[model samples]
Target: MTDYGHDLAFGSFLTPSAGTPEQTVSLAMLCEQVGLDLVTFQDHPYQPGFLDTWTLLSVVAARTERVAVSANVLNLPLRPPAVLARSAASLDLLSGGRVELGLGAGAFWDAIEAMGGQRLTPADAVQALAEAIEIIRRIWDTDTRGGVRVDGDFHRVHGAKRGPAPAHDIGIWLGAYKPRMLQLTGRVADGWLPSLGYLADGDLAAGNLRIDEAAAAAGRSPSAVRRLLNVSGSFTGSGTGPLQGPAARWVDDLTRWALEDGISTFILGTDDPDDLRRFAAEVAPAVRELVAAERTAPVPAAPVPPAPVPAAGPAPLVQSRHAGTGFAVVPTPDDGVRRSSRRVWDEAARPTGPAPDPARRYTRQELVGGQHLIDIHDHLRAELAQVQDLVEQVAAGSLGVGAARSHLNTMTMRQNNWTLGTYCESYCRVVTTHHTIEDQSMLPHLERADPRLAPVVDRLQQEHLVIHEVLEGVDRALVALVSTPTGMDELRAAMDLLTDTLLSHLSYEERELVEPLARLGMH
Candidate 1:
């Protein structure tokens, strides 16, 4: 086995479609919302049907809060190393240190030449890429007291000033396959990125051997280079093939790749939103869990040493002692305040989950799964508060409706809006996505794990439908606000209903499901 001991990362490789720019960016944001680690786009500057990858990366970074962005493999021939270095550094600084560089030697010579890039042979291309990597590294080395200098046949940077280091030590991954490129990757690159479709049987093993050998010869550890693969597959209900069956199948395949092939990062090249959701909510977590178990599994002959026991001590006495429940997670309580007289569902009719057994003990690690659900809900709550604040600012004439609309539109929250309408719409979409994930993935898993919780799960799903309608009502109010301009009361009413339903529903969910999730886990 060739496990590299790298922490597993999941990501999406999206197409920057010019035809549906909004959808593309929305999918990128969804990757972050669903807990993916990275978001990448393929670079094809010569293609008219695609958005410029660099520009799209900038927009995606702005739209998302915490997802690394990169080009799958930027075409190095078309982009100069010196300028690319500065651009990557600037974006890394702007995005709060979430940028990775994926570089590739030139491909599609005819298109590249047509776009004013130099055409070279395969050997020359590899050599040129090496020179570009040198130049790019030199440009980022601000601590070195002198101008960057790299003199090569393909690229020369003579006395070029080097400053503006990236916010973090950005990883330079290479899309390499050939012997020369593999050797170069092992010697210098931080990662090896290859598309699964480009590799045949045994190709990964063979390539790893070459890279490992090269790394050893260059006085470096083979584990220094992280392995990332771009994968594409379909999600089916039954067994089809590798990565083409259910989420469990994908997890099994990915776990094997991680343990045996040392592939730590799996980037799915998909455009379907459902696939993205399943990949994040199901496959990613399972793979991480499985890989972790195996990595920490005890060896056959070498038994692990027992943990040291604490010294015995007398128990402290308390005045008013009572039996305690093992569950420690505290659900957010509903404030029971309403801004509007409207109500979506009967609050008293909500079903309660079965009470947890006081005898059951839960580990801190196990309880974390329940806390994670609360963390996600807290983020939604914060965003909702921001939406309300923006609305109040616009209402008080502190923020211009046109300027707010323009800012949101530039972020691609929605196509059209007035003042805080787009921000509100974005928040609505996030709420909808969270509910959809619960309705489709988490609720089903919970139902299977604990049949006694059926009434609670059913009620949650029903509330999800009601919230969907509330969101649609918000959308309508936004449309009216755009046309009538004096429809702030209607908009405010819609927001009030949303706040009421969403907050109440979230608290009910936490109260009911937290214990079960802690006991049964999120699988």
Candidate 2:
């Protein structure tokens, strides 16, 4: 096994479609909301249909609070390294050090030439990229006393003053495939990014060997360079092919990659919101859990000489550890309070999951499965509070509609009631998407794993529908708030109803399903 011992990370790779600029930004924000570690966009600056990758990255960084942002493989031919370094450093500072650089050799010579960028042969392109990397690093080396200077065949920089260092040690990841480029990645780059689609059978192994050899030859540890793969596949009901199956299949495949091939980062190339959610909520955590288990699993001890039997007196009584005591996942309990007079479902009548067997022992990994559900719900709870706070600000006149609209315009959440409506709508979509995943994928899996959970699953599905209707009510109230002066009261009422229904349902679901999930697993 070639495990590099790096922490695994998951990210999203989105197309910078200028046609739906707002949606692109929204997807990036959703990456952060859904607990993804990074967000990336492809760069094709010559294409008129796509947004400028740098501009989109800046906007995404501004809008998202946690997720790191990067261009999948920025075209170096069109961007000068000295200036690119400064721009990256500036954005990294602004975004609180969440910027990564993914650079590439030039491609599409005709388009590059048309855009006033020099086109070169494959060998020349790789050379140019190496030269660019040197200049970029030199420009960022502000601690050095002298000005940055690099003179090469393709790029030349002399006496360029360097300062304004990045907020963090930004990784320079290269999208490399060819031998020379791969060698360069192993020698200097912090990461190696390659697309899975472009790789054939055994290609990943071969590439890893090459990179490792190059790293060793350059007096560097192979583990110094993190491996990242850009992946795309369908989510089917069963195993169809590699990465083309349910979330369980994804977990298995990615875990294998992490353990055997040393790929520490997996970036899903997708534009569909549902796929993004499933990848984040289902596949990512399970993969992390499994990889962690294997890495930490104890190695078999060498054969030890058996100790001589002592006095065969009374046989030592072996007491098995208590089972129920080890099940540490505690479900969040409902406070039995309601914010609104409106009631969606009769909570008292909800069906309970099958009782746990007192003899069944639970492992730490199994408990994490149940805790994962609560963690996701906690994120939703926090976001809902933010939405409510935004509404309150608007109601109190602390934030005027025009000013809110202008502020939200920068985020690109374009809607009639700019601030409150945009936020509420986003939250509503997240709730809807969460319910959809559970209904379609999670609940069905639970039903199959243990038929006794059928009734509980059925009740949860029903609650999901009721919650959907409540979300629609909130959306309608938002629309009214845009045109009617008396809409604030109605909006508040809708939010109160949503808050009550959502929290109660979430608590009940956790109470019913947490133990079962811990026992049976999320898949």
Model 2 Cα lDDT, one tens digit per residue, 87-122: 999999999999999999978989999999998999
lDDT of 1 by residue, 1-523 (tens): 6898889999999999999999999999999988899999999899999999999999999898899999999999999999999999999999999999999998999999999999999999999999999998888999999998889999998899996899999999999999999999999999999999999989899989999999999999999999999998988876666788766667767877897899999999999999998898777866765566566533223212333333575322110010145456666777778777888789899877767775676776667666767777777787777776666655565454555544554332233345367467656766765676577668889999989889999999999999999999989988877677566667778888888888888888887887889788877
For all predictions, the C-alpha RMSD in Å is: 10.3, 9.9
Q: CA lDDT of 199 in candidate 1? A: 93
Worst 10 residues of 1 by lDDT: 314-323
Segments in model 1 whose C-alpha atoms lie over 4 Å from true places: 302-523
| Candidate 1: clashing residue pairs, number | 0
- Candidate 2 residues lying further than 4 Å off, grouped into runs, are 305-523
